[model samples]
Every structure is written in structure tokens, then in C-alpha cells.
Target: MNKPVPPPRLRMALIGCGQIADAHLQEAAKVDSVEVVAVCDMHMDLAKQAAARFRVPGIYDNLDRMLAEAKPDVVHITTPAHTHGPLTMKALAAGCHVYVEKPFTLDAIEAETVIAAAESAEKKLCIGHDQLFDPTWLDCRSRIAAGQIGHVRHIESTLGYPISGQFGAVVAGDPRHWVRQLPGGLFQNTISHPLYRILDLLPDLHPRVEARWDRTKYDFPTELWVQLRGAEITGSLTFSSSVYAQRVTRVYGDQGMLEVDFDAQTIRRHTAPKLPGAFGRLEMPFRQWREGARNLQRNLWRFLKCEIHYFSGMRNLMAEFYRSIQQDTEQPITNAEMLRVTRIMDEIFADCRSREERVEEFVPETRELEVVR
Candidate 1:
């Protein structure tokens, strides 16, 4: 007997029709299991344009109206930082799973509120710290677990880029707006990725941060230094927006080191010496390794076919949200982790406000990393 096939698509609603929203639309279109049924934006014109481009039937200037009309199973919020929590709460209350843009909310309190709302509603709430969804991150986790570099002792990650402020200005479309008012800032946007990544990789670590910013000396501080603690490792992250685009992460251990360029899709490892050398030095030979660019290019091509790898990590996250909701299971990236990241952000901001000149040492309570089943 022939069996009936389940429907391939799940209905989706987009709550913001901005630049990031377009990336969502493009990616959602490629996933055979999802359909964008409607779009809403504060700007009606932008919503209309997005709907037309995505071929969604419904468009609205109001989120409530859109939700009432579309009744989508998934609601994606790509709104500005401040509006994320409110919109997510509203969506969850309406019995819809949510995928929110980065930073989740402006502060930890807002994140807690939304998380509680999602729990009460029994709907899934996922943040868009997409870097965790990257395959490179997955591979990194696997290697770390296998002790490929022994015990991870320190980590250094950085992201920087040349800026005209044109992209942000266009998105905000208001010269005096806060998003536009701050040019080349890491706190508001860029640091979210590295912070989230660290939390994801080192789940047991609670980071305490001390940061300094000088607006007169540099555009938007342009640099952030963070020290993190874990049961088995202690790490530091330096993020800067002033230099040309450079993204790299180095994981060091007692035995050796592993370096990854996420953007470049490359990984290199240095092994410990198996034998002693003349000067009592272990003489661990340095070896260069690369994940052929062609392989990375091919994976990227496959990823782009569905707009998967775009926007840092949203596509993979949306898939996980769907699975979590359907299976009624806890997601790998949880509200607890998000809250921890928020706390770290808060510490950084508070430290910046104090104008502290030196890094403050913090001893974190160590909890061992449980092996993933």
C-alpha cells in the first residue's frame, strides 16, 4: 500500500522588512519545509515591496494585524534592537515560535521577560546568534571534545572592518537615530557573535568583563577586550571594528593549538612534540594545515542554494527552532546561555561607563563541561 506524504512546508511570518529581513526571505524560500506567508513592517511601503519580492500574499504595517490574518506557525523578528523583546513576546503569546535577530534584546532584563513569556506560552524562542549554527563551529566543538588540542587554556577571537556608516545609516534612514548616532560600535552589534560563540563553545564558563571606550579618541571605542573563565580553560577575546575585516580564533592548550578562520573556512593545528630536543625544548614541529578552499567553496555553494549560510547563522537556527517546537525538546542554545551572554554584555557596558583603565580580574565559579550525548 502507498503511504500518504506529509506536507513539506511550514507557514512563516516575517515581522520586519529591512535588509536582514530580505536575507530571511531568500533563505526561507530555499527551504522546502517552510513558506513565508506574510510580512509586516512599520514602513508599509517596505512591507509591500518585500511581500512582492518574496511573493507572499499578505502584507501589513502592523504585526498584530499580520499575525491575526496569517496565523503562521513561525514568526521571525528582524526589527531594531529595542523592539525585539516586545515583538517576540507578542508572537509567543499568539502561539507562534519565534526567531529573533541578534543581541536578542538591549539588556538582560528584557531577555528574561521574553524568555519567561515564551515558556508560559509553550512556544519556542530562538535568538539569531547564527555563528553557532555554522559548520565550522560544529567542527571546532568536535575537535575540542576529542582533545585534539589537549585542554583549551586560552582563546583569542577578533572581527574588524572598514566603515563608512553607510550601511547602518541606510538601514536606520535617520541621521539622528541611535543606530546611526553610534558609528563603528562593537557593543551594539558586532560583539554579539563572538560573545555568543564563546558561550556556545564553553558552556560552563561565566565571563566577567571590564571594558573601556573613548569616543573622542576613536570612533565608537573600536575595540573591546574580554576575559572568560571555564572549568578547564581561561580565555581572552579582543574585538575591534577599526581595522580592515579580519576574523580569526586561536584555541591554545597545554599540548598544542588550533586556529580557525571562520570567514575563510580554514583550520590549522599545531601538534605537541613526541620526543625531546637538544636544549630541553620539546621541539614540537610547526605544521600548516588548510581545509581546501575548494571544499569550503563547494559547501558555501550548497549553502547558498537555499541562502543557508547567509546572515552569519540564521538559516540553521530557524531549522533548529522548528525541530525544537515540533519535538517539544530543549534547544542547544538555551535562554540560560543567552542570559549569561547578556550578563557579560552588561558588565562590559558598566565597566565602560566607569572609564576603567585596566582589566579587572574576576574568578568565575567553575562547572565541568558535560559530554554531549
Candidate 2:
């Protein structure tokens, strides 16, 4: 087979010199058709530090200055969630396609505004919902598409993170952290990952959200359950602070089930055997063992091939975003998907906050009625 021709080189600039900027730069370096021309941060020293570290050609403390000078074909927004909408608008206005990190904005309205700006500017806006493009994640979708897993009846996505992780530690230490300012608190910052995974399988663009925050268990909410009711498929997202830190999504299909574990980077399928119940039960363990062995072998091969990167999904996502630019094709992650995820998040935040207010109001009324009695 003939190797495909390479796309023309495109200039790229990165904003936000936070922890996530490193990930973006690492992935950008892997994309052969793109050059990291500039790095920007609100602080010049930080911007200079990142520019030096990545060997980027230019550094700027202002978005407009960088955009005018770098004249990049694409801009990567790695800033905080609160800053996403404005940064996206700035980039799109500057005539550069934007690749923004997830939790598109603080609310759906903000998301809609940015989408409109991107559309008006005739540019593509791709969010960093990178998990959906993962190798195991893609394999699961392919199985469902090929009818190997039958029809997907439902999906369950779970994110179990530690309350004492490096980032969480910063938030825990100070109420003034930007994450705490989010309407849904830390949940808002992280829930987009698993929720998008479930949303990708559902047919409906809009889903009914029923969520409850469990804060009484501790000083702050450490567990949350969001029930999503879609047209044909129902899904749930569970975010909890637990001792076991793991990430997994299970797709419940009619013929069988598939589980994608992000932490282990493994995909396993479970199916009913054609034999009798007892024999099927006996064979199931062997089937599982075989799958485990297969995954191990695949990982070994990938490691030896040097195709294993900690953030391979992030790398692949950038590659496709650039491909869209090169081919003059549709975005890898469509603008519609970005809006849907944000809308769902907006619904969740509103529901949670409204319920908390209702509870407080009811408590005062109940106390008054008790005194009257």
C-alpha cells in the first residue's frame, strides 16, 4: 500500500501555561504537520518558561499579541474552565481554529455563544474530550457498530478519584481555589470525561438529567450520582471520592457487555455461551482469563513498538483536529457534540444547586411548623 501524502505544515499556538499545557505540547510535538510556534500565559514569566521548555518560537502574555504575531492555523486552549469561553472567542475571532479543553464553558449559554462565534467565523472548534478517542474506547464503539455486541441497551460510566490527589489536595486546602468556585464544585471540573463517554453511545442529542449531591457524608460532597434519561438509551454517571482511584465505562449491550478500563487501558467483553448453564459458567472464567492474556500481549507489543504513550488519546485527538484543517473536512469532534455535553452539564449544575436551595427553605418552614404545633 502506498503511504498517504503528508498534510501541509500548519502553525500552532498554545495558551495557558498550567499543568495541562505540558500534555498539549507533548502531543503537539508528535504531530508532524504542525509547529508549536508560540506559547502564552497571563504571566510573561510563566509563558517564557513554557516557551523555553517546549522550544516554541515565540512567547506572549497577551492573546491578541500572540495571535497577531504567530498567525497560527490552530490554537489550543488549556486554560481553566472559567476562561474557556472567552479564550475560545478570542481565538476564533483571530481567525484560527480552536482546540479547547473539555467542560466547554461554565454553562450551556456560554457554550452556545462560543459555537455561534466559531460558526460565524467559519472555523472549527474541537473540545478536548480525549477519552472518547482512546484505542479501547474506539474498539468498544466498533464492536457495537459491527453488531458484535448486539444493540447497546445502556451505559454506566464511573470515575473514582482520590480526595487527596495532587490537585484535590490544593482544592482541599483552600476554599478560594478556582475549582471550588464552580457551581458543581470539583465535580464540574471532572465530570465531563465520563459523561461524554456515555453520551457518545446515546441516540438523543438532549438527555433528561436527574442528579443528587451527597455532601452530608463529609464536610463537602464526596459522592454524586447523575441519572441520564435519553430517548432509546438510559445512562448514569457516578463520580465519587474513594480509596480506589480508577476509571472505567461499561456498555450494556443486548448480546453481551464490554468494559473499558482507562486506568489499566484494557477492554474486556462478556458473553453468554451456547452451552448449558453449568458449562457456560465454567467456561466464563477461562474466557475472561483468555481476554486478560490477550490484553497483556497487546500491551507488550505496543510497548516494544514504542506506540504506548500515557496520553495517546490526547495525541490522536490533536492529529485528527489538524487532519480536518488539512483535508478541509469536518472536525473530529463536532461542534454539536461540544454543545450537547455542555448543555447536559448546565442541566446538572442547575438541578444540584436548585435542590440545595429547596432543602434549605424546607428546613426553615419545618422548624416554624414544629414550633407552632
lDDT (0 to 1) per candidate: 0.71, 0.87
Tens-digit per-residue lDDT, 83-178, candidate 1: 788889899888898888887877888888988888888777777777777766667778888998887777767766444465633433444555
lDDT of 2 at 342: 85
TM-score of each model, in listed order: 0.82, 0.94
Write down the lDDT that model 2 would get: 0.87
lDDT of 2 by residue, 258-370 (tens): 99998788889998886788999889998999999989998888889997777888988888988888888999998888888888888887888788778988898899999
For candidate 1, the per-residue lDDT at 148 reads 89
Task: Mark the 10 consecutive residues where model 2 has the least summed lDDT.
Answer: 213-222
Q: What's model 2's lDDT at 165?
A: 90
Q: How close is each model in CA RMSD to the real structure?
A: 9.5, 2.4
